[model samples]
Target: MNELATKHAALASRFQALAEAVQDWDAPTPVAEWKARDIVGHLTTWLPEMAAGYGIDLPKVTGDDPVQVWREHSANVQALLEDDAVTNRVVQTSAGDQTIAQVLDNFYLADIFMHQWDLAKASGQSVGWNPEVATSIVEGMTPMRDMLAESGQFGTPVVLDESHSPEERLAALIGRDPAWTAG
Candidate 1:
């Protein structure tokens, strides 16, 4: 497995685990109006649709079972990471045409990493976070805060104390209430 594959496995394992542990698919997440299942749905839906433009035929999620939805998606993404022929294919982006692997590293994997907390919180579980990655995410995104908000991908920033961990700060930056818990 490559670096992207390894990272995806590590991050996606947490996501899949949370999906399995979910006591309520309908449990609300910090992202208002989203249920635990929506986290899985979002991850599963977007990437396949996005990758289709690059000619990589990944599996589209078919069922509402969050665990199964995540499992299928994760497996296919991992396969893509390991497939040199597919990963090397170029796709156009703001950064110019880059390989599928690069795009995955920059976007899909990061998204999965960030959403781990959302799914975990909704499922009443805890997820491990890498402060380094969290810091990088915050730093990289802070400059694009306005564009991100305008795109409606993130919400108004949630304030946190200086003592908050990088992961908590990341959650807040991405529009999740760091202190939010499942009801």
Candidate 2:
């Protein structure tokens, strides 16, 4: 697998493990309104949508099974990474057409990091987000935050802790409380 694919697989595995754990856990998590199920559902929903934005049409499921969606989307992402036609190609978006590399390097990483936190919050699990990956994702996404800000895709900016983990910084960068609570 290429670098992007490798990162994606690592992230997926982490999430899958968390999903499994949450299935058995009865303890309350901070994101009370959206338990572990919702976090998985969100990843299942958005990951593919993001992949689809890259010009690959993942398998469409009849209902809202985020797991199935994630699986399908992940396949597409993998395919896109391997395909020559898409490797250097640019997919059009509201932000404009970005290269596949850019999508993988910048957007995909950020999405995974944020969703990892989302999953952690819902599942009441701690994330082991790599500081290097987190830093790279933040650097890649920082330029576009201004554009996303006007569209309200990113949250209000706040002072951040430099020593914070990548997931925490990433969550704060996008305006989500890394320590968000349902209550």
Candidate 3:
């Protein structure tokens, strides 16, 4: 796979790892008061939202338990992923208008990169990402500057330090504090 596809695949791996790590994890943190389940729920919610931007009707959240909502939504997201139209086309949304390429570049790829860190901290698992993917996300997101400010409510501020690893620094620069520990 080329760099972009590789990055996407890597991010997909990280998201899967995050999902696995946090699946049984139960705790609360800054993103939401619920737990890691809620964080996954939120990501699951956005999956179809992105599909909607691509003109696909995805499952909607209408449940009390965030985990159940996420489970249903994840099923929809999985189905959408199987559909070429939803995955291959880009569409605009309340977050920001982006082409499919840009969405994959910025949101689908980068958002998940950062969210891995978020999920890691919230679940007490290592959220470390490969440097190449981190660098790619940072570079891609640079042009879409405002997207972070708009939909970044869930991300914690990434704290920078000269001694930090490239991935850690990249994470911090985007809003996640590498040193953060969920209480």
Candidate 4:
């Protein structure tokens, strides 16, 4: 596996751990109206529609088993990243013609990195990510603050001190309270 594949696998592993640790699917998440299960649901739901644009068909998983749904979805996405034919194809996106690999790496992977914290906290499990990766994600998102807020997909960002950890900054920038904990 290459760098993108490796990153995807590592993020997926942490996500899977949180998914399996969900003692209550209905637990509230920092994402306003979402729950522990909705975190996985959000990821699984969006991926297929995005993959379809590249002529890739990802399986639609039911919510009956959120952990299994996440595992299967993650595996399928990883397989696509590993497949030369799939990853190499050029696809027309709003951003223009980008290889399927670029689309997956830039969007899907970033989404996973953001939501992992939500899932972990909601499930009453601690979570973290590579700081460099977290910083990179924050940098990419900073320029799109207006667009992100308008999309309603993200909440209004909170102000944080420079001394805050990158992960905390990430959570704050995404409208999540970094200090949030499960009840």
Candidate 5:
């Protein structure tokens, strides 16, 4: 697999691990109004739509089991990423038209990575994510912070100390409070 695909797969793996570790799907994540199950739901729901733009048909996952749904959908996304043809295809996005590979690299991959942290924080699990990836995401999102905040998809940005890690900074950039807990 290419670098983008590999990174997405790694993020997916981390998400799966967090899903497995969770004892309570009802636990609230740092993302306001989203629970542990909702984190998985968001991924499973959007991935197939994103794949559709590349002419890929992913199987529909049913049932109340969020982990199983995420597993099924994420596996389909991984399979699509493994195909060079699918990755190279151009697709229309809300931002504009972009290659599937670009979308994966800039959007889906980042979403999954952040959501991994959300699930972990919600479930009281620890994740050792790649700092390089977090730093890169922070850099990429810095310029888009206002637009994203205006979209209502994200909450207001939380202030954090400069001494915080890149992952925490990235979380703040996207309007997530890194220190948030279910309590």
Candidate 6:
């Protein structure tokens, strides 16, 4: 498998694990306004629209079971990631035209990565994510911090003390407070 495919698979695994672990769909998340179900809903709502730009058809999620909805949509996305025709296809976005691979790397994968943390935090589940992945995402997105904040995609970054770890810093960079706990 290629790099993008590998990354997608990693995300899929995390999502699947979260699905199995979660017992409450309405559990609050660190995202403030979004609940556990809303996290899945957000992804289910976006996957099809993004895939459509690459001429890939994804099944619409219809059920109220957020886990099932995520499972179905994520499976479709994972299949598309494995297809060269889908991954290599160029698609137009607000940022201009980019290959599906590029979009996955720059947007979808990062979204999944961050949301995995959200899901875990909301569900009170622990996930041992690869440090390398977190570090890479942090390094890649740090330069765009101002733009992402301005775009309303992320909250204002939280100030971290020097004692914080890289992963904690990454979480803060993406507008998630490392100290956040689901109420």
Off by over 4 Å in 1: 158-161
Query: TM per model?
Result: 0.92, 0.70, 0.66, 0.92, 0.89, 0.89
Put down candidate 2 lDDT per residue, 1-183, tens digits, no spaces: 677767777776776666655543333444444555555555456655766765566554334555555556566666666665666787776658777767675656556667677666655577777778778767766776766577665566443667877777777777677777433
lDDT of each: 0.83, 0.63, 0.61, 0.84, 0.79, 0.80
Cα deviation at 86, candidate 5, in Å, is 1.4
Better of 2 and 3 by TM-score: 2
**Compared with the true structure, what per-residue lDDT tens digits does model 3 show for residues 48-113?**
676665666877776655445545655554555555554566566555765465565555655666
lDDT of 5 by residue, 1-183 (tens): 887778778888888888988999998788778878988888777767756656778765666988788788878888878889878887887879888889877767878887788888898877677888778777767777788889887787654556999878878887887777777
- Candidate that beats the other on lDDT, 1 or 2, i.e. the better one: 1
Candidate 1 per-residue lDDT over residues 1-183, each given as its tens digit: 777788889888877777788898888998887988888888999999988877879889779577887888789888888898888888889889899889999888888888889888887787777788788788888777777778788778664555889888889888887889987
- How well does candidate 4 score on lDDT at residue 83? 80
Q: Tell me which residue pairs clash in candidate 5.
A: none
lDDT of 4: 0.84
Misplaced by over 4 Å in model 3 are 1-13, 23-26, 30-34, 61-75, 90-105, 142-162
lDDT of 5: 0.79
lDDT of 6 by residue, 1-183 (tens): 788888788888778788779998888998889988898888888878867756778776868888778788888877878888878988887889888889888888878878888888888887566777777777777788888789898888654544777678778988998878776
* Span of ten consecutive residues with least summed lDDT in model 6: 157-166
